[model samples]
Each structure stands twice: as structure tokens, then as C-alpha cells.
Target: MSKQNFVIGLTFVIGLIVGGLAIAVWPAPPLSTPAGHALSLRVPKNRQLLDIAISPDHSLLAYTAITDGRTRLFLRPLNRFEATEVTGSIGAAQPFFSPDGTSIGFFSNGFLKTTSLYSDGATPITICAVPGTPAGAAWRADGLIVFAGPGATGLREVAATGGTPVMLTTIDQDAGETSHGWPSIINDRFLLFTVGKHGYDPRLTLLDLETKDTRPLLLADGGGFVVTPSTLVFARRGELFAHHLNSKTLKATTPKNPF
Candidate 1:
């Protein structure tokens, strides 16, 4: 098959595998009761959903979909059925919401950008140029954004509005480290990220924003998130695992357990 045909076929197979998934929001407590509901996402015919992110406040959901060979971001309010296209978000991917939920940060055309959700026709404001595809990013509470840039090691940070990005961690090549990405900020002083190496499982690592110290929490296949102050959730082989964390000390208090 031709290269274009091969790409299309691959996308179709991926869509078939992932399209049936739905977003389920479980309510706090009442584990025996069915207080949660699934959000059935609607994608345009022939388009495939690329990524999805919920707003910090849980009021809106932003996702990227491939339409007519281009990818763009779409905003869907939790209470509404229709999803609205985000203006100037063409080529967007791996979107993350700002702390206030009034704006979104995304990667588009080798640049890290942000756009306001409340604006009538807001254009994306470029923050910095990234050489390769970013693994993931997080918006910090202190008007800064941390991201795993396309590089061999370490992470970078840039101002929320727009500015030059600076390296946030040192390269640990002696440990056979290849890349660092999938940053999840856990308050102003702590962060969670994935440390990757060739031919090995990715390590879920923690970083001290103040001291620049890092420690591996566990082996994971993908990035992780700080679901709660004391709960760190990560993915491995299509299954989710949770680690009990001491939020104040930034340490893993228990072994990895299935979530």
C-alpha cells in the first residue's frame, strides 16, 4: 500500500480500538451507589479523537480531533450535547487547561501556545518553539507552564502568557536516561513526571520544584497524574495504578496498588 493509505488504515484501526471508550465521572464517596454518568463524546464522521482534557473546574471538556487531515481543538460544556470548535486551534494537540480554566495551553506546529476560552475570536499566542513532539505539559499555579519538551532529558518551563523557556532539570545521562515528559504539577512545590529509557519501562518520578531533587516512585508505561493530595495515579499496560503519597514530604508512603 502507498504511504498515505497505510497511515489512513492505521488511524482507522486505532479509532476502532479506542472510540468505544466513554468518560465516566465518579462522585465522591457512596462507592455502592451509581451517582456517576458517562459522557458519550460525539465525533464527526470519519474523524478520530486524538486527545481529551477536562477543565480544572470540571465545567468544560476540551478535545482534539482529526478532521480533513487537520487536527483542531473542540470545547464541550459538560451540560451541553454539542461541541464547539476552538477558533485558531488548528493543528493543536495535547491540550492542558490553565489553573483558572479560563484558557488552554496546547502544542501546534512546533510551537507551544495558549488561547483564551472566553474570547470571541482569540488567536493562539505562541510561548516557545519546540523542536520535536512534546510528550505532555502542565500549567502551574504560579503563572508558569512546565512541559516535557522534545529532548534527550529534563523538562522546561515558560511563562503562561509568552516568553523564552528555560530548562527545569538536569540531564542524568549516566543513568541511561533518554527523555523526561508527562509533567503533572502537585501544588507549587512538587511535580510528577515520567522518566524514560530505551528498552526499559518508564519510571514514574517525582520532582521538588524548590530543591530540584527527583526520585523514582514506580515503573509505569505512561505518564501519571496527582488525582488527590495523597493519591498518585499512573498507567501501565492499559491498567491504572495508584500510589499513596505523602503530600507534605513528597514521598511514596506505600507500594503501587491497583486503582
Candidate 2:
């Protein structure tokens, strides 16, 4: 099968702490080893972790860290204790894995770029220029990437290889909507994102990729992800919450509960 046709099957967990750096991975229950035990990774006193993402198969991790006054991306296998820096990933932030876990996508120097994880002397490939710092991005199985760009007011779609981006969603200024960001691809035709304004009020929203329609799912303070086909997870006030999601209708089937 083609790489673009690959589907990611692992759960995505993100941990971000401002001013300090600590990374913990808590695998879901019922594994060969006991669950809920966090595997913490620490950085040196001089370096600081900024953002992180897990590979699709959960065997590797990609994170952005400040080292030598430059923000760069690093890769760490779960079985290893140290992470190696990606050479051409200076200024990289918000790193994410490709669907097949062979490359990583990140924002650097006002552009979205990708780099191979295993190639020798591979340089970062520039996908497209973004207006401002991106809020978040997700790679879809169909070879398209959706990201929130340019003040995070709307969503934009660009090919994974490289191309000009087209607007996907328009913010409803009259409805007090200020920005739309943190996109998670549910499938080829639907997306989960967050809608926010000046204050901390954020709503989990669902967008139809085919029709360009949107629907509010719940009140969430951060990005939401479909952990499973029937479950959605998000955060509110630093606490995680889960909901029974009807993926077909893109609606929450149950009330929010602590995750």
C-alpha cells in the first residue's frame, strides 16, 4: 500500500507545560505492563522542552526543545534514554508525525516543513509559508494537511508534499468567534478543532471537509482528539475530559466526564 493510504492507529497524547519541562507518557489500561504509570523524561538544566508528539505506532517520540538558544526537534525511541536532534529542524515547534511514522512535520521560521526520520543527511522540505505561528496541525490519510494559521482565525488546507494553501473555515466574527485552531483529523472528510476568543472560553467544534460546514461539539479549553472510533478526549481548565462520540454524526453522545 502507498504511504498516503496508511492509517494511524495509536492514541495521541500531548503534554505542554509553560516555563518548565517534563514529559510523561501514560499508556491506556490493559497492556502487558500495568497502565497509569507515567514514564517521565527529563532534559538537562540548560535545555527546555516546548512541545511533543508520539509516533503513530507509539514506538517513538518527537519533541521540540530549546538548545543552545535555538529551538529544534528531537527524536527518541521509547526503548532509548536519550534523544537525538534533527539537524535541519532549527526553530521547529509543534512537531507531529506523519501517518506512516516515517517523517515529522513542524513549524519553523514562519513556514511549515517536514523532514525524514531515517534518511541520511536529509534536509527539511518546505511545505508552505504560514501567516503566523500555527496553533496546531494534523496530517490526513489522503495526503492533505489541515492547520490553523495567520492569527489562528481560520483553518487552511495544503498538500503534505508542498503547495499553496486554501482557506477551509471562516471565523464568524458576529458570533463572538475570534479564532479557530488545534485541528485533529477524524477521517478524510471530517475534522475536530477548537474555537476560541479573547478569553479562555473554547469550544470543541466539528468541521465537514466536504461541505465546509461546522458544528459545535462541546465546551473545551484546548484541542480535542478522537482517541478511539467511539470516544473523544479534550481538556478544560487543565483537566482532561472524555465523551462518547458518534463519529458518524460528529456529535457527542454522552455528557463530558473526567478522563
lDDT tens readout by residue for model 1, 1-259 = 5533433333332222222222454324346633444566677796787777877766787888899899999998877878988889999988889989899999998999999987888687899988777878999999999988877958999999889989997667887889998787888678888888878888888888888878888887667666556766665654555677887776775554554
Winner by lDDT: 1
Question: How many Å off is the CA of 215 in candidate 2?
Answer: 1.0
Top TM-score: which candidate number?
A: 1
Model 2 lDDT per residue over 117-232, tens place: 87775899999998566788999888888888857378888999999998888888887888998888786678888898666578988888778778888887668767567767
Worst 10 residues of 1 by lDDT: 13-22
| Model 1: lDDT of residue 198 | 74
Q: Which regions of candidate 1 deviate over 4 angstroms?
A: 1-34, 253-259
